[model samples]
Target chain A: MEELSKKELVLKQAKLAINFGVGVIAFASIWVFQFTIFPDFFKPEPTIVEFIPDSTEPESVSYFELDSADIENGIHVPTGLIVDDGCQDVMVTCGACHSLDLVTQNRATRDGWKEIIVWMQETQKLWDLGEKEVVILDYLAKNYAPENTGRRKNIENIEWYNL
Target chain B: MSKKDSRRTFLSKSAIATLAAIVGSKVVFAENFPKELEPVGLQPDEVKVKIPGKSDQLKILNSKPLSAETPPHLLDDEVTPAHLMFVRNNGIPPEEVDVQKWTLTIDGESVVKPMTFGIKELMDNFDHYSYNLTIECGGNGRAEFNPPAKGNQWGLGGVACTKWTGVRLKDVLNKVGIKDDAVYIGYYGADTHLSGDPDKVVISRGVPIKKALEDETLIAWAMNDQAIPVMNGYPLRLVCGGWPASTSGKWLTRISVRDKEHDGPKMEGQSYRVPKFPVPPGTKVPDDQMKIIESMPVKSIITYPKTGAIIPKGGSFEVRGHAWAGDLKVKKMEISIDFGVTWKTCELKDPINRLAWQRWKINVKLPEFGYYEIWARATDEKGVAQPMVLPGWNPKGYLNNASHRIGVRQG
Candidate 1:
């Protein structure tokens, strides 16, 4: 057994006193919190909010909905698809399922349009177009065909305006 | 082109215009006049009927196939509220879903015994568990790509961390008895295709069998202890945390185990896949070379103080946000005031469970602030830190986990 010198014995007593004090403080804090702070009884009921929609508001215009009426009435907006006989077939056959944006967003070639049609028929459950496919193809290829095959040009430099 | 028309400015440069611009505002418009009548100046979904049970702040990207996103500030909550969760739909959610009649059929090349478990049966038989999991769109930051990719232009808001309650997908797969040859698992949803073809599915995508069997991958029926919002796959959904949300099919109807990769809509043909190698922005990679996006990259969003925030004169404020790594733990969270010149470590906390996003906070002390962009970057356990700038871009614009930054003005 190692015997402690007088100085070592005093230092060990101080370390023991600090440890005991810390332990007592920690235990007391835990006891105080468990009794006062963490009570389990008499919990409040949870409130769920019910949603109410305004019944009287008028319909706001959507960009998609805004031009749809003009397109349906055969009044050509200078911006939209070319108004020809084939436009009707394209509208009814293609627009029946998805939005026209799907068509207008693309700039594909004749073969590309045909390829999309084939994909639709094979996967999207489009009925066989037979010969009507030719007319629809013509409209899409002529109007929406590739003017550019890539994405929008990046704006590299900005010209500052003089105020 | 006419000489005068080509030289003309968009808004007239009158004395009043010049004075007004110089007096208070620093904004300026460029030199082309738009000819078309701008459609109703009202914001999207402003005049239209509000989507029931969604935050008014959710930015609607498209209406027909209905896509919307949460602004980052709205996602400051620790667990994303149901109403604020971003909605990215492939097709219309099936109308009139009956939870009582809901059934999940398990079959395909890899199952020993094909089985159909009713929703009730699933709830009663399996041990239920809840986990806080993160799901982010594969194309979360598509808007930043130069020569912009043509898809939903999402910013940083297409993600959420939510507590999902459900049965373990592995437990159910075990009941069905997976064959040793099982290579992949795919799910089909009841969402109607835009073509409204009863026969055609909207999207059917899945993950590798190993990912499918993880503890956090769930056949979830409830979110935040309540029935999920109808727009978010109400009765049943497969919650594959840490993967692209597209892989976690909404309104799940069937589970198919495949001996090979499941060939479903959007699973191939560059839908959720990216280039096998890094491609320059706008480079169109061939379909055969593209690979499906699996576990998402390490990402973080500073969801406090909002962008364009004005800091108080003190030059001190606490910055807090969420950080997540796909199928891994976040090893470190850092903030850069000098745009990657130097970074300050934040107090990062561990996630409550595997696949949950970890929260981090820091007392940001700005050196001197005029206009500073506080950038948040997260590093995963594998030591892969987020790229400070836009990452390698592919045609579809997927998996852009760049460091997120917000502008703050300080004196």
Candidate 2:
């Protein structure tokens, strides 16, 4: 058997101790660093607030309801765009939750428009249009009629190949 | 050192060397593993959901299945793999609920009564069975519009065929007694807080009475013979065969029978519409430029060749695809290898049901090495087939059914 020199023994001892120390420190630090830093890294950032309709107000307009001026323009205007036509108090109330563009863009008949406003008031909490219902009817009947030209353009003309 | 001590020293020395070797190899092994598997920065679910967005509206949901494609061979047998099935949701998916607590409400212009029944009541009162049906988004192939309209811009994977077991919608309506004036039956989803429209905070859509009375229209509780996953509208949902995604509301909770049509963005003005006139390509149509969207056109895609795969010379392979039509049956499917110069007819297998997609197959001999474009077109019995040219483009994009094409290379 070869006998080890004292210098060699000392060198071997120092090497083993240092390697063991490094391994222990590395393992411990890996766990500690991970435990300490991980939560923040994985945390979810703040999300943009999604729109929520008012649950409390029963008189608020349904988002789809179109006011009278929109009917006159033949465009379903958003609630915000309804001009302050002094004809009726209902336009002011209908303009609160939506823009006049919503109403103007739609092409519903007078009855259909009335039902929509009623649905908004009943289900969506839109406020009453007060006594302006007649004006809204006249506005919708005169201008917001559906265009006959656009109805026939659906799937009839497309070409289809064999199976 | 003693012999045992010497052995320990040797083992420890070798172990240290091995450790160093492992650490070095690990860096290389990390490269070998997919970047997804490594703990770079995100969790598994987060990474799974973050499919690079193709459109502005295609959100990365935290829970829905990541993809909608399955290997042809894996789909060889009955039952589409759950992961491969297409997902159609109007809004964020709802969490799972106890089936017993959930209820289906049937109300509106119906004469007999306003009634709400639990799932058990529905199952017991009506015949329960499974039928195969295909549900596709209204915007499934919308990305193909010639003018490049704005929508999800989904690829060919936005559809799925599945076996849904439940009661017929007509049976439930009959029990409630449909009024004479009922022209439409609107379906409302329980999934709440839809993002875009205020009136649409609760999205409700409907179908004509003719379709509502479809014997195949089912109030499905289970999908693929298992409880429908939460992402796919758990508890119960209405599946309207041959109709677009908007017609079949997910997380369905209410049924309202109406004398007149249900009017909403999803109904009167959106989801189903076409251009008022055939316009030039690449046009962004104004709102006034559109007409209402209706029946789906015929469309087919080559599911094989794996998109850019290189097949060996003299390789003989089978090409397969799926085709479906709205309100009519697919009569024939044709395959064109020479860019429509000459066409070969493919064999279309019998559909599992009238509503499901029919599988098509053709054998092709891969010619000399070059890039080949494989084209498939389907035609319905009504002679309506996929159009090569799309003339309609609208502000709210609708109805994009162009012939499906894929490119492959032969080495």
Query: Taking the candidates in order, what DockQ does each have?
Result: 0.02, 0.01
Deviation in Å, model 2, residue A128 alpha carbon? 24
Candidate number of the best DockQ:
1
- Report lDDT (Cα) of residue A155, candidate 1: 22
lDDT of 2 at B366: 64
Candidate 1, residues B1-411: lDDT per residue as tens digits? 121232233223442234223222311111111221111111233225366679879987655567789988789888999999999888767766778888999999999989999999999999999999999999898877665555677888999999999999999999989999999999998876665344567899999999999999999999989898888888899999999999998998899999999999999887899888887765757899999999999999998767766666666788889999998899999999886799999999999899989989998766664767888999999999998778887777788888888777675
Model 1's lDDT to the true fold? 0.76
lDDT of 1 by residue, A36-155 (tens): 876653466633222222466322111012245445445344224466545645544554445444565555567767877887777666657655578788888888655431332222
User: What tier of docking accuracy does candidate 2 attain?
Assistant: incorrect
lDDT tens digits, residues B113-224, model 2? 8899898999999998687776666766544443333334454556667889999999999998998888888887665432212234455777878789988888989888
Which candidate gets the maximum TM-score versus the true structure?
1
Q: iRMS for all predictions?
A: 19.8, 22.4
| Candidate 1 regions with alpha-carbon error over 4 angstroms | A1-96, A99-163, B1-49
Give the DockQ of candidate 1.
0.02
